[model samples]
Target: MVDNNWLAPVWTLFQQQPLAQGIGLAAMLVGISAFRQRDDGRFRLRLCLYQGAIAFHFLLMGASTAALSAGLSCVRTVASGHTRSPWVMAFFLLLVWGLGIPGINSPVQWLPIIGTTIGTWGLFRAKGIVLRLSMLAGGLCWTSHNILIGSIGGSLIELSFLFVNCHTMYRMWRQPLPNPS
Candidate 1:
C-alpha cells in the first residue's frame, strides 16, 4: 500500500474546526467578490469586509499572527481608500513590523507580515493594474502560509483570489487607458 497520509492533517483540521472552515468559506466568497469589482473604491470596500471576515476566520483557527495581520489589513484597506498619504502608509508598515516581529517563531510566520507589507504599499502607491499585480504577489505568500498551516479554506481563498484578480486585470487591460491630462 502506498503511504497516502498527506491529506490527513488537512482533513483533521476540517473535521476539528467546522465553524472556522465555514467562516473561511464565507471569507473566500467575499474576497472573490472584492477582486471582481472594476471600480477601485468598490473594490477597496469589499476588500475591507473580506479582510475583517478572514481575520475572524484566522482567530477561530488559532492562527494569531494571521488574525492580527488580517485585522490590521481590514483597517488599512479602509484607510487606504481615504488617503494615499506616504506618512499614513509608513505608519501602517511600522505597525505591522513592530507588532509582528515579536510573534515570529519560524520563517513561515514571516509570510503574512511580508504579504501585508506588499499589500499596504500597493494600496498606498498603486492603482488599477499595478495594485492588482502587487496583490497577486501578496496572495502567493498567503497561499503558501495557508497550505503550510493546513487551512483548506484559506488556501482556497488565496488561490481563488489569484484567478479572479488575474481576470480582473485582464479586463482592465482590455479597456483603453484614460488619456493623461
Candidate 2:
C-alpha cells in the first residue's frame, strides 16, 4: 500500500554503466542458454506444473518489481528468440501473457487460478516423465509464489528447487538440440 517506487530509476554510481549493461547481456545469454537447454525440462517441469506455473507467473504480474522484472525478462527473452526456438515453451510464455499481463492494471488476479485448475487435469492425466516434471514444476511454481508473497521458507526452498532445475536444464542444453517440431 505504501509507495515503494521500485521502478523509479535511481542515479546510483553504476547507473547506465557499461559493466552493468554487459552483465545484463551476459546474464541474458546465460539465461537464454539455460532456457534453451532446459526446454524439455522447463517444459516438462512447467508442463508438469503448468497450471500452477501459469498461475504463479500470471497472478503475480506487477505485484513487485522483482515479479515484473522476471515476467518481462521472460517476455524479452522470448522476443529475443529463445522461446521461439522451442515451440512448446512458447505455449508456456503464452500462458504467462494470457493470464498474467492483463493483471498489470486489473483486479482479476484469480484468472490463472481458475485456468490452472482447469489445465492441471491435462497434466495429471499425462503419463511418464512429462507428467512427473509438471507436478514438480507446479510445486515449484506454488512455492515460488509463496516466497514472492512473503514466505521466508519459500525463498530458500525456491532457490534450492531453482538450482536443481537450472542444473537439469543446463544439462539438457549441453546435449544435442532436439529436433524442432
Candidate 3:
C-alpha cells in the first residue's frame, strides 16, 4: 500500500491530467459497449476500439506497461478471428512479453503482463465457456492493477466488465446447445 503522505501528491498529479482522465472515460465507455455485444465476433471487433482508447489513456498517464499491454490487446483482438493457428498466437505472446521486459520497474507491472497473456490466449484461441472464464480471471487481475495505479476509470471499467461479462456467460450457459452435424 502507498503511504498516506504520498497519496495527496499522487492525487494532485492525477487531477492535473485532464486529457488522460477524459481518455480513460472514453475507454470505459467503449469497453462497456464492447461487453454488451452478445456475439463473440462483434465483441472482439468493438474491443479493438476500446483497446486503442485505453492504450492512449495509459500512455498519457505514463504507465508504459499498461499502455503496451493495451496496444497489444488491440493487435490480439484484431487478429484473433483470422486464424486459430497456435504458431501465430505463440508469436504474439512472445512479442508481448518481450515488449514488457523493458518496463518492469515493480511487481505491480506483472499484473498487466500476466493478465494480458491470459486475455490474448482466451481471445485468440478459446471459445464458449473457456473464453468467458479466462476473461473473468484477466478482468480481476486488471482491476487490481488499475486500483494500484489509481486509474479510477480503468478500475471502474474492469469491475463493470466483470459483472457484465459474467452475466453474458451465464446467459450463454443457460441456452440450449446447438444441434451438431
Candidate 4:
C-alpha cells in the first residue's frame, strides 16, 4: 500500500489546470472507449469490459470534482432512460472513483476548471441540453483534427455525463430538501 506520497500524485494529475483538465477528462473517455469500443461484434464481451474501465476512470475525475458544482455522474443520473444499458457504463465509472479517491476540480478539463460546473447546471435542469452540449463539444473537438488531444477533449463530454448520473443519484438520496410553496 502507498503512504503520504500517494496523495502527491493525486495533485500531480493533469487536473491542476483548465485545459489539462478538459483535455485530460476527454482523453480519459476516449481512452476508456478505445479500450473497449468495437466497430464490430467480434469481441462484444471484451469490449464491454473495456468500456467499464473507461467509465471507471471518468468516475475518478467526477468524485474529484467535489463541491465544485460539477459532477458528471449527475448528468448520467438525469439521462438514465435515454441511453442503452447505461448501468454497465455507470458501474465502471464507480470503480475508478473508488480506486483514485482523488481531490476536487484539479485541472481536469480544458477551458473550464470544472466543466461539470457549467455542465451540472445544464444537466440538473433535466432538459436535452446536457447531451446536446456534450455532443456538440465532442463534435467540435473532433473537427479540430488534433487527433489525440481532440479525442480526449471530445470524449470528456460523455465521461462527465456518466459521472453526473451516479453523483446526482447519491445526492438525491443523501441530501434532503424542504417543502416548496
Candidate 5:
C-alpha cells in the first residue's frame, strides 16, 4: 500500500495553527491578485500586502528565516515601487544575507535567502516581464521550503503563484510594447 501518512503533519499544522494558515490563504489571494494587475505600481502595492501577511504567517508557524525573508520582502517591494536604484538594491541584498545567515540550522533555511536575493535583484533591476520571471523563480524556491517546513498555506500559495504569474506574463507579453519618447 502507498504511504498515506505524509498528510498527517499537514493536518496537524492545520489543527494546531488554523489562524496562521488562514492568514497565509488570505495572503495567497492578495498575491494572486497582485500578479493580475497590469500596472506595475498596483502590482507592487498588492504584493507588499501579500508579503506582510505571509511574513506574519511564517512567524506564527515558527519559520523564522522565511518570516525574516518575507518581512524584508515587504519593505523591498514597497521600495521597488519608489525607486529602482542599484544602491537601494545593494542594501537590501546585504540585509538579507546579514540577517539570514545566522539562522542557518539546515540547508532548507537557504531557500528563503536565495529567493529573497533573486527577488531583490528583480525588483530593483527589472520591470514588467523580467520582474515577474524572477518572482516565478523565487516562488519555486519558496514552494520547496514550504513543503519541507510543513506549511500548508505557504505551499499552496507558492504553487498557485507559479501558475498565476505565468498566465500574467503571457498576458503582458501579448500587449504591444510601449512607445519610448
Candidate 6:
C-alpha cells in the first residue's frame, strides 16, 4: 500500500485545478457517449475524442503518466479500428511497456502502467464481448490509479465506466444475433 501522505499534496494540487477536473468530467461524459454507440467504427471515433480530452485534463493536472498514456490510447484506438492483426496488437502492447519503463519510478506508478497495458491489448485486439470485458479490467486498474493521483473526475469516470460498460455488455448479450441470409 502507498503511504497516505502522498495524497495530501496531490489533493491540494487537484483542489487548485478545478478547470482541469471539469475537463476530466467532460472526458468521462464523452467516454460514456462512446459506449452508447453500437457500431465499432463509431465507438472508436468517440473514444478518440474522449482520449484527447483526458490527455489534456491530465496534462493540466501534472499527471504525466496518465496524460501520455491517454495520448497513446488515442493513437491505439484509432489504429485498432483500421486493423485487428496480431502483429499490430503486439506492437501496441510493446509500446505500452516501452513507454511505461521510463516513467515508472515507484510501485504506485504501476497502477496506470498496468491498466494502460491491459487497455492497449484489449482495445487493439479484442472485439465484441471480449473487448468490453477487457476494457472493464483496464478500467479497474485505472480506478486505483486515479485515486492514487487524487483525480476526482478521473476516479468517478472509471467507476462510472465500469458500471455503465457492464450494463452495456449485458444489453449486448441479451440481444439476439441477426439471422444469416
RMSD of 2: 14.8
Displacement of the residue 159 alpha carbon in candidate 6, Å: 0.9
Error of 6 at 126 (Å): 1.5
TM-score: which is higher, 5 or 6? 5
Please report how far candidate 3 places residue 149 from its true position, in Å: 0.6
lDDT by residue (51-154, candidate 5, tens digit) is 99999999999999999999999999999899989999999999999999898899999999999999999999988899999999988999999999988889
Name the best candidate (by lDDT).
Answer: 1
Cα distance off (Å), candidate 1, residue 75: 0.4
Which residue pairs clash within candidate 2?
A: 37-173, 48-134, 48-135, 49-134, 49-138
Flag clash pairs in model 3. none
Stretches of candidate 1 off by over 4 Å are: 1-10, 176-181
User: What 10-residue stretch in candidate 2 is worst by lDDT?
Assistant: 46-55
Give the count of colliding residue pairs in each prediction.
Answer: 0, 5, 0, 34, 0, 0
**What are the models' TM-scores?**
0.92, 0.27, 0.88, 0.26, 0.92, 0.87
lDDT of 1 by residue, 1-181 (tens): 9887997887788899999998998899999999998788999999999999999999999898999999999999999999999999999999988898799898888999999999999999999999999999999999999989888899999999999999999999998457569
- The regions of model 3 sitting more than 4 angstroms off are 1-14, 176-181
Candidate 6: stretches off by over 4 Å:
1-14, 177-181
Weakest ten-residue segment in model 6 by summed lDDT? 171-180
Error of 1 at 61 (Å): 1.0
Ranking by lDDT: 1, 5, 3, 6, 2, 4
Local accuracy by lDDT, each model: 0.93, 0.40, 0.86, 0.37, 0.91, 0.82
Q: lDDT for model 4, on a 0 to 1 scale?
A: 0.37
lDDT by residue (1-181, candidate 4, tens digit) is: 6579755544554445445455445445443442232221222233233334433433444432221212333334334334434454444345324433344233333322233223323323333334334423433432232223323433454454345433434453466334348
Clashing pairs in 5: none
lDDT, model 5: 0.91
